[model samples]
Target: MPTVPSANPAEHLARTVDIVALLERGRAMSTPVLRAAVDRLAPPMNTVSSYHFGWIDAQGRPAEGDGGKAVRPALALLSAEAAGAAPEVGVPGAVAVELVHNFSLLHDDLMDGDEQRRHRDTVWKVHGPAQAILVGDALFALANELLLELGTVEAGRATRRLTTATRKLIDGQAQDISYEHRERVTVEECLEMEGNKTGALLACAASIGAVLGGADDRTADALERYGYHLGLAFQAVDDILGIWGDPESTGKQTWSDLRQRKKSLPVVAALAAGGPASHRLGELLAADVKSNDFESFSEEEFAARAALIEAAGGRDWTSEEARRQHAVAVETLDAVDMPEQVRAQLTALADFVVVRNR
Candidate 1:
């Protein structure tokens, strides 16, 4: 049986050839369509939208760095290429996926009470919850509107695909919130929730390009599976980073997920291990929760908890799981016949998903 790839930091870094550059290229191609759609919103709504996208400051001045890595748009365009279509043919789909992604981020930040994102105050923190909610709704609506502009039949298909994915995404978020209140959660349950919350949108982004590019259902479905597995790998890596990443590099507070008591994959896996380390972790977590002292942990205590989690094998398990999911993602690509260059790019993107540090 094939084992998970060894974690050679150098090898991983070697494979990590600036996937962000491809994402940026896709962003450049799709930004005009996205801007036109957002501009259709009312005055303050447009302003809030612009701020959230990192195009402008809270004071409505044009500032750089409003958006994300544009990963979804890149996947859309790449999927389109894999289906034997020009990347431009996927522009509308790319824009639609990106809009929906930002909409989720806006709402998620509010729901999670996250004050900061990408090293800036979130929309809710800067603009208030009501405006944040409104802008999120507007973005979702605009995504649909943009898709419909693709012509009736294609628009209808894309809309159905996106809406179904959106529903699953919402359900996943709901499950995630609910998990926080529960005393015990299994790894299987955690995976399901992450798959729904993170995987659904990525699946849509990947398949939408194929649909728009006139690929048959089989090719689109294969790409969707590829994205689904890739999403799982992405989230698993993100879970690892949440606990161990550099605050300066990840642009978040140190141990941010643990600070929030989030039941991320590694945390749940640690809890489920049911040994001395697991018991110790549970005690620490419970103490924090019972005393309402989540913020009071010293660096030493945090380090101890992280060590306990590693001893419980949570870190190693999650890392291997990420590699396993990445392997599956690459395998799924074989189901479709695409240009070698496109296939290589997609494979590289899959490797980057598991190996990325931030």
Candidate 2:
């Protein structure tokens, strides 16, 4: 577990606490509930989901593998604590958000034709696209079932929030896929798409626990705002990693976003910068769009495009934007009334997102 980079002197105490331990607490609490939900799926769906969750190998044998960062679940639990409820009170919300997150991952991997995730074969590559779609749908439905079965008003409220976020997530994915074919996508448009795709779900995760704990709309909304900005910061950093992160750290090929021609923050910002490097980068990208045979691009070609994108200031602009969003996220917390310890943890989590290497 790597140390979380501290954003300020005030965060020193929280920064000293291991973020991995915080994430593990979320994973440990949610795994049993998550597994139970998945177990309810019939036949191959259950088996396939187990494999996707890294609980089992493709052969159906048990094997510990990368599940995920469990960031959402951690936030969920902390949100409950923020609302003066026990962490266990947030388990259902934690599991539900995790379900929704994985559901998107399944569909996104298939839609993007990504063959690997977390250093393992993706569900689509291992089982087939049809199975991937079916399992993703099942997980989504199970998420609703888990919450609804609770039969509490809070549960109902949380479900409504989760469904709305899921819809926005879908919308974001649609926009993302469409952006790939278009020659020009404005930075504003990209931010809107990302807000829908990544921000919505994180907003839900950040607030759903509090919703379940019976927090008022005002508190929930403020927390959601915090999460929404944090998501943007998270995505900005992710965009950086997608283009510049090491293959070993990112678990993807070099110039991964470039190969996919994703109109991510860096690309869009660079295109918007309007200079010699920007013009050349746009021309090269346009040529790729015209040819549209991204698979044929060599390592040298991808390297050249990446260099142009940086020279155009895409990388630097996005780095600054990440810190800006992170600051805004932390500021939002000031408006909420919560325990100082929980607030520290949330601030630390925000710091983790901006500084995470992978």
RMSD of 2: 1.9
Which segments of model 1 are wrong by more than 4 Å?
Answer: 1-20, 287-296
Native-to-model Cα distance after best TM-score fit, residue 355 in candidate 2, in Å? 0.8
For residues 160-241, what per-residue lDDT tens digits would candidate 1 score against the true structure? 9999989999999999988876657799999999999999999998888888888888998999999999899989999988
Candidate 1: residue 301 Cα off by (Å): 3.8
| Candidate lDDT values, in order | 0.84, 0.91
User: Which portions of model 2 miss their true places by more than 4 Å?
Assistant: 1-10
- The 10 consecutive residues of candidate 1 with the worst lDDT sum are 1-10
Query: Candidate 2 residues 1-358, lDDT tens each?
Result: 1133345544866667678888999999999999999999999999999999999998899989888789999999999998999999899999999999999999999988888898899999999999999999999999999999999999999999999999999999999999999989999999999999999999999999999999999999999999999999999999999999998888888888888889999999999999999999999888888898987778999999889899999999899889888888888998888988888889889888988888
Question: Alpha-carbon error at 326 in model 1, in Å?
Answer: 0.3
lDDT of 2 at 26: 94
